[model samples]
Target: MTPPSPATSAPTPTLLWIDASAGIAGDMLLGALVDAGAALDDLQSAVDAVIPGSVRLAAHGVTRAGLRATKVEVEVLVDDPPHRTWTTIRDLLVAADLAEPVRARALAAFARLAEAEGRVHGIPPEDVHFHEVGALDAIADVVGSCAGVEALGVTDAVVSPIALGSGTVTAHHGVLPVPAPAALELSRGWDVLAGGRGELATPTGLALATSLAGACGPLPALRPDRTGIGAGTRDTPGRANVVRVVLGTPTRGTTDAPVVVPADAGPGGTPERAVVLETNVDDLDPRVWPDVLERLLAAGAWDAWLTPIVMKKGRPAHTLHVLCGPEQATALGAVVLAHTSTLGLRVTSVVRDVLDRAWVAVEVDGGTVRVKVGHRAGRVVQATPEFGDVAALAADRGVPVRQVLAQAQAAATAAGVVQGAPWDPVDGGPAPA
Candidate 1:
């Protein structure tokens, strides 16, 4: 596979910020997107590609607590099947004739639901049966929502803290808490709130939200060109029971620290900003710390680490620190909250001056190890071989890791990938040695 490289010509991605402050459901989100201009016919066509004439979708404008909103209702035309297993659902999606992205998104959402259900019921994910989510309407909601998102051309999404609701409700498993166990499981690494009475967020809804969501935070700075409101069943007396969608292009140089930096930055290095999310945990199992860090990095954190500390009453703890792009603050914060015993997170925006860098591949023994070269003012300031590459080469050749590291260092130096060497603008450094 070719190595990763920075994008040089991609267009600025469009942002779809979902406001689930009131709550969210599969149909609620779909309605919001439709109201915001995602064509309903397109959604129906996509759903038909999968279920094929089994489900129908229609939308109408209505008022929820004095606010106008759209409600898209799913009507099943055929006899719905009994509870379906994750394996069955997976096969159906794999054979679906939908767009690649739409199919992929739907599959991901269902996969999350299956995993959550499996964990809650102590069954393997493939063997877990989806009861409520297996219903025809639920299937329509999941598939149509994915298709709606694609129709709008939304490239990225951020979700606000979700409202899980209060009280209890009855379901296929009998009486369950407001935020059903499966929903709660799926919401593990997301910001959530109990915004109202009854079940505001359902498992299917949370599955879709968490699957599509890239981050969780307040709406970033953007010039919204379209807004849509989707109403839930109840038109509660006071508050509007609705989900909101805001579509726009992110505005740079505004609050929430834009990722794009101005070109006039000083010569010392390029100045960019990142957010630091920190939290302290004392009650978590120590054995799980490594997994926590791994999850954070996998979730898009630039870096994650732990610092030991002592809390009140001499209790020992560790403060988890996550450094990430501003856009990733809430998402990474959610990961920390989910994996650790922390009840809150502290977010701080920091400006960093970073040197220009490039990658160089050098032969160590017979293996290639990529070296990261940092430079400033057209001079190489630092050069270091990637440890992952070095370790792999050591394992392959059955040599001591240190020996491989030493040889890689010498190879880099011989290749002029050293401090103070004139930087090569072509691909950031000299060609591989």
Candidate 2:
């Protein structure tokens, strides 16, 4: 059996955009994924169904500015184009039924663009009209990324230091300087390297990427599971000439480790390289727990969970546990007090040894379930299907979810989808797959 199943640790996707040394665009990003051999047809179909108004979605193999790549574009094929506003675009996308978090991310990305356009034209976000980025193709790029992340089973999206490049680029608005105003605004709060000898980062790449990344820092260590490249239209002599996505898990002690990395050791050793803050309280009203938890997470605690225990004289008390990286201790502490009855908190750090991880799509119980694959070197140590997906599939198939799950386990093993993986038992994990 596989050492363990990752059905337990499914990660939110991480995106890494490799500056092509040339530049990138919406279609180029889509094409690079297709060219690099990612399953994108399903994603394209979802985008078509959701986009309101009329838009035709298609992908083709082509070269941009002398770079060989695939270009995904939406054709309006109308006599006149539609002029859209911030609210108009947001409402339309929201109606399309995109995931809630994805919708928020897209809006934030677009907002940054609008803010940049306004600054260049000297207007406000509400008044600014982002004509180019507000278009259908741009929406596809943003939405498609969410879909692509799901399709690829990517858990962690990390990015390298950006290379902004050199020179001026002319656009519909005017001949602006390299990097553009909107691109500059989107890249704020992140480490960026400019003058890569040519115009490197594009407004579309910067805006879409930064918004989704959520947090900006150095490239984290990952054991790549899938590698997909999104190419730009141009080709230069030396650069990779594409935005490459390396899908994998974040583990301990790798060449790609974080500057102030998170340790993977069990709780005791885990605190070594991480922030450990604890507190005890028995007098606080129970009504305030939720706010305290939220404050801690927002402040920087990677996680916070409370445990009930008996203190001196058997007085009922709760022990608060907060674990995070070194960077978050101060903010996390302030948040704990502002929301809880704890007059004080204890803090410390220690070393952690975490298992290396990745993800794979295993066909279990007649449906495709996302199985997280943890690894060390090249060995796949464990794999498991996420119960949520299995539950939904079971509900749809009109059968006992457990039966479907067991079948999927058998199928995955037989099909060699997850070799040497121990199948999770129905009684323990979930009745569903």
Best by lDDT: 1
TM-score of each: 0.60, 0.56
Candidate 1 to truth, TM: 0.60
CA deviation > 4 Å runs, candidate 1: 1-9, 132-134, 253-433
Q: For model 1, how does the per-residue alpha-carbon lDDT over 189-230 read when each residue is reduced to its tens digit?
A: 799999989999988888888888767888878888888999
In the range 200-268, model 2's lDDT, one tens digit per residue, is: 787766766655453445545655555655666566555556665555555564233344435443222
Off by over 4 Å in 2: 1-21, 36-38, 62-68, 132-134, 195-198, 214-219, 235-240, 254-433
Query: In TM-score terms, which candidate is top?
Result: 1
Let me know the TM-score candidate 2 reaches against the reference structure. 0.56
Worst 10 residues of 2 by lDDT: 424-433
Alpha-carbon lDDT of model 1: 0.80
The local lDDT score (0 to 100) that residue 74 gets in candidate 2 is: 66
